[model samples]
Target: MHRVVVTGLGIKSPAGNSPAEAFATVLAGKSAAAHLPALLEAGVPVTFGCQVPDFDPDVYFPKHRRRHLDRPTQLGIAAATDALADAGTPDAGRPAGPGTAGSGTAGSGTAGSGTVRCGTYVGTGGANIGLTADFGALPHDKLPVATVPMIMPNTTAARISIRHGLQGPCLTFSCACASGSIAIGEAAMAIRYGRIDRALAGGVDSMLNPFAIASFARISALSRRNDAPQEASRPFDRDRDGFVMAEGAAFLVLEREDLALMRGARIYGEVTGFATGADASHIVQPLEDGSVAARTMLAALADARLRPEDIGHVNAHATATTYNDRAEARAISACFPAGSPPVTATKGVTGHLLGAGGAVEAVFALLCADAGLVPPTANFTGGPDADAIDVVHAAPREIERLPVVSNSFGFGGHDATLVLSPR
Candidate 1:
C-alpha cells in the first residue's frame, strides 16, 4: 500500500484565518468565544458563539460568483484554494497534462501532467441551514433561482472540484461532528489504494444565523453563560453547562508519499492511520460505557501499526458537554494505560465547530506534531473530574518525535480517529 502525507493546510477558524495564525492563537491560549450582538438583539437564548471575524467573501470570490454560494461553500472554496496553493499545485486554469515538466514537484509544480488525478472530499454538519431559513422567509416571487444549488450539502465539494480541476472522485460526508475527520480519512485511503494521486479533504460548517442558533438552543445543546462567553466552553469542568456554537472551515492537501517526494513537496506529516465506526447505542448521546469509542481508537492504532505508548498526545473530541466529556474520558482511559499521553481539548478556546470540529482539530494535531508542542486547553477551571486524564493546561508542553491521535465522535454514534506522525 502507498503512504499518504499532508502537503498543505488551510483554515478559516474562529481563532484565525490561516493555519499559522490559528495555531499561534491556540498556543497563546486565546479564546475566540464572544457575545453575538445579532443573537443578543434578537433575544435568542444562546447569544454567544465563535464566529470567523472580518471574513470578506469578496477576497475569495468575485461579486457575481459569490451570489451562487452559501456561507459554508464560500468558506470551503477559500480553504481548498489556499490548500492547493500551499501545496504548490498549479492554477486550475493552466493547461498541464500528465508527466509535464513542473507538474509533479511541490514548489511551483503542476499536478504532474494530467496523469496525476486529483480529487475533493469535504464534510459538513448542517448544509446551508441559514440559507434555507432565508429562502423560507423570502416571498415566493422574490426567492432566488439558485436556492437549491446553494442549499445542497454537496455544493461545497462540487465547488472545490470545479475550482481545483479535480477530475477524480468528488464526495461529501455529513456524519455530523465526525464529518471532517471521516472525509480526511477516506481521502488518505484513496491515496493508499492508488485511486487518486492527491486530494483536498476537510470540513466546513457555517450556521450561526438566528434560526440555527435557536434550533440548538431549543435542544439545550448550547452554553448559556452569556455573561462570560470566554469561559463558557469548559470541556471537562464539572460546572460546564454545554458547548458553545462556532463556525469555521479547515482543509488539508493529501498526496501520495512517493508523488510528494518526487515533486519535492514540503510534507507536514504522514497520515499513517484512520478508522471510523459507530456506537450502535444512541443517536444523540454517546454510550456511557465508552466501549465503542475505545474500539475506534484501538482500531486506528492497529491500522497504524502503533502501540498505545507510541502516542505522545491526544486531540480529544471534547465538545464541553457533560456526558460527552465524561464518556470521552472513559474512552481515553480504556484505550491507554493509566496516566499515559497528555490530552488537550481545543473547544475550550474555539468553541464547537460542529461538523468542522474534526477537521480543524485534525489540523491542530498535525501542527502539534510539527512543532513538538502540545497546546494548552483554555478556560479550564479545575473541577472534581478534571483529573480524569492528563489534561494539558496552563502552558504548552514540548515532546520529542512521536505519533499523535485525533478523535472525533459525532451524532448518530459516528466515531472517527486518525493517527499522524511527523515527517
Candidate 2:
C-alpha cells in the first residue's frame, strides 16, 4: 500500500459552510441545534435539530442545476467541488491504463497527463423518497416528476461526479452512520493502490422527513428533546437521550503523499490507518462485548504502527444515544489501557447527520490535527454515566503534538476507525 494524505477538505455543516466557521464553532463549544423549521411540522418527537441554517445552494450551483437537486445532493456537490478546486485537480479526464500517471493510473495511454485521474466515493442513506412521491405527483406532465432528483443513496455520488468533471469510478457506500467514514477510507485506498491519482470521498444525507422521524421515534432512536433542542445531543452525558436528526455534507481530497508533495498541496494530515468490522450482533443495537469495535480500533492503530498511548485524543462517535455512547466508550477504554485519551464528540454540536455524520466529523478530526487543538464538547454537564475520560468542555485545548483516532459506528453493527497523524 502507498502512503495516503489528505490535501484538501470542504464542509457544509450546521455551524457553517466553511472550515473556519465550523472550527470556530467547535472551539467555542456552541450548539448549532435549534427548533425545527415550520416546514418540518411539530408532531415529530425530535423537532429540534442541527440544520444548515442558511445554506444557499445557488451560491455554488447555477439556478438551472440547483433546481434539480435535493438538499443532500446539493450539499454533496458543493463540498466535492470545493475539495477538487482546493486540490487543484484539473478537469483533464481519466487515464486509459494501469500505469499511466494521468488521472491516477501509472499505465500507458492515461486520460491526459495534464489532468489528474480521479474517482468519487460517497456514503449516504435512503433519501427523502416519500417527499419525492408527494411532490413528484404535481402532474407537470403525464409522468410524475421526481420532487427530489437525487433521492436514492447512489445519486449523491453520481450527481457529484456530474457536477465536477470526474470521469473515473463513482461509487457510493450506505453503511448507515458509518457510511461517510467508509467512503473516505475506500477513497484513500483507491489512491494508495494507484487506482487514481486523486479521489473525492465524503457523505451527504437529508433525512428530516416525517417518515424518518417517525421511524426513529418508533424505535426509540431519536432524542425527544423537543423543548430544549440545544441540550439534546449529550454524548457521554448521563442525561443523554437519543441522537438528533440532522443534515449536511463534508468531503476530502485524498492522494498519494509524493504526488501531493509535488503539487505543493498544504497537507492537513495523513490518513495513517483505517480498519473496519461488523458486529454481527444485532440489526440496530451494538453488542455488549464490543469485540468488533475494539478490534477495529486496534487494527487501525496496528496499521499505523502506533501504540494506544500514541493517540493523544479521540473523536468519539457519540450520537448522544445512551446505548451508542456507552458502547463506544467501552470500546475506547478497552483499546487504550492508559485511561482513554482526552475525548470530544463534535456530534454534540452538529446533530447526527446520519450518513453524513462520519464524513463531517472526520473533517473535524483532521482540523484538530492541523490546528493542534481539540474542540470542546458542548451541551454537557457533569453526570455519573459519562465516560471517565477527560472531556474538553467550553473551550478548546491545545494538544500540540500527537496522533489521533476518529471512530464511527453505525447501524447494522458496522464499525470503522481511522488513525490520523499530523503532517
Candidate 3:
C-alpha cells in the first residue's frame, strides 16, 4: 500500500478564491453570508446566502468552449487548474507510459505520458439537475444542442479528465453534501491501493439559483435572518436556526508520498485516514443518538492508526441546524468520552456549501493544521449542548501540532470524514 499526501489545493468559494485569501478570511471570523437582491425580490423566506465574490467564468475558461458546460463544471475546472498549477505540475516532457516500470507516473512528471496514469475524481449534488431544471424552464427549442451532455452529472468529471488528459478512472460521486469528502476519501483509497498513482479529487456545488433557494425555503431548511445575514448561521448556538444555502468549488492534488518527496513538492499535509458511514435511520435527520456518526469518526481514527486522544481538534460539519448540531455534538462526545477537543465550525461564516462544503472545509482543516491556529465559529453562543462540547468561538485558538478530524455529513444519512495530520 502507498501513503497519500496533498501536494496542492485550490478553492473557489464564498470565503475567497485562493487558499491564502480564503484561509485568511476564515481566520478573521467574518461571515460571508449576505442578502441576495434577487432572492429578496422573489420574496424567498431566506434571502441570504454565501456566494463566490466576483465570479466571471470568462476568466476561467474560454467563453466559446464553455457554452455547454454548467456553472459547477466551470467552477471545477477553475479550481483544478489552480491546484495543478499550485503543485507545479509539469505540462509536458515526461517518460512514456504507466506501463513503464517506475517511470514517474505518480503525478510527479507525466504530462507527456502516452498512457497517463493520473485520474479525475470529483463530487457534486444536483449538478446536472440544477442546470437542466434552469434550462427546462425555457421555451422549447431554446435549449442548446448539447443539452444531453450538459445534464449528465458525470459531465464535470469527464470534462475535467479530458481537459487535463488524465486517462485513469473518471468518476463522480453524488452523495449529497458528503459528496465532497467522499470524493477525497475514495480517491485516497484508490491511490493507497494502487488503482492509480495520483488524482485530482474534490467537489463543486451551486444552490444559489433562485429556484433552488425557493425550494429550500419552502422546506424551511434555510436561515430566515434576511435583515442580518452575517449573524444568521450560528452553528451550535442555542438560537441557531437553519443552514444557509451557498455555492462554490474546491479541489486537491493527491500524490504518492514517495513520488511527492522525490520530486521535492511542497506538501501541505498527509491524508492519513478516511472513513464513511450512514445514519440509515432517517433521510434528512441524522440519528439523534449519533451512533453512526460516532462509528464513522472512530473508524477514521482507527484507519489513521491513532487513538481517540490523538485528535487535537475537530472541524465540525456544523450546519447550524438544530438536529445536526445536537447529533454531531453527541457523536463527538461518544468518540472522545474522556473529554472533547477544540471544535470549530466554518459554516457559521461560509454558510452551508452543500456538496462543496466537505471539500472546502477539508482544505480549511489542512490549512488550519499548517497554520497552527483554529479559527472561531461565527456567531457561536454555545447552545444547550455547550457543556458537553467546547465550541471554539470569539477568537482563534493556537494549537501548533496534532491531527484534525474534518467531518461532513449529508441529507439521507451520508457521513464521511477525513483525518489530516500536519506534515
Choose the strongest candidate by lDDT: 1
TM-score of every model?
Answer: 0.95, 0.92, 0.94
Which window of ten consecutive residues has the lowest lDDT sum in model 3? 100-109
Please write out the lDDT profile of model 2 over residues 264-319, one tens digit for every residue.
77888888888999999899999775778999999999988999989979999989
Task: Kindly list the per-residue Cα lDDT of model 1 for residues 38-129, writing each as its tens digit.
Answer: 88888989888999877888888889998898888888888888888888885633445556533332212334444566778898999788
Scanning candidate 2 in windows of ten residues, the lowest lDDT window is 102-111
What's the true lDDT of residue 199 in model 2? 79
Off by over 4 Å in 1: 92-114
Model 3 C-alpha lDDT per residue in residues 125-224, reported as the tens digit of each score: 7686678777888898898889888888888888877777676778999999899999999999988987777788999998787788888877678888
Every candidate's lDDT: 0.86, 0.79, 0.86
Q: What TM-score does model 1 achieve against the real structure?
A: 0.95
Each candidate's clash count: 9, 13, 0
Among the numbered candidates, top TM-score falls to 1
After superposition on all C-alphas, the RMSD of every candidate to the true structure, in Å, is 2.7, 3.0, 2.7
Alpha-carbon lDDT of model 2 = 0.79
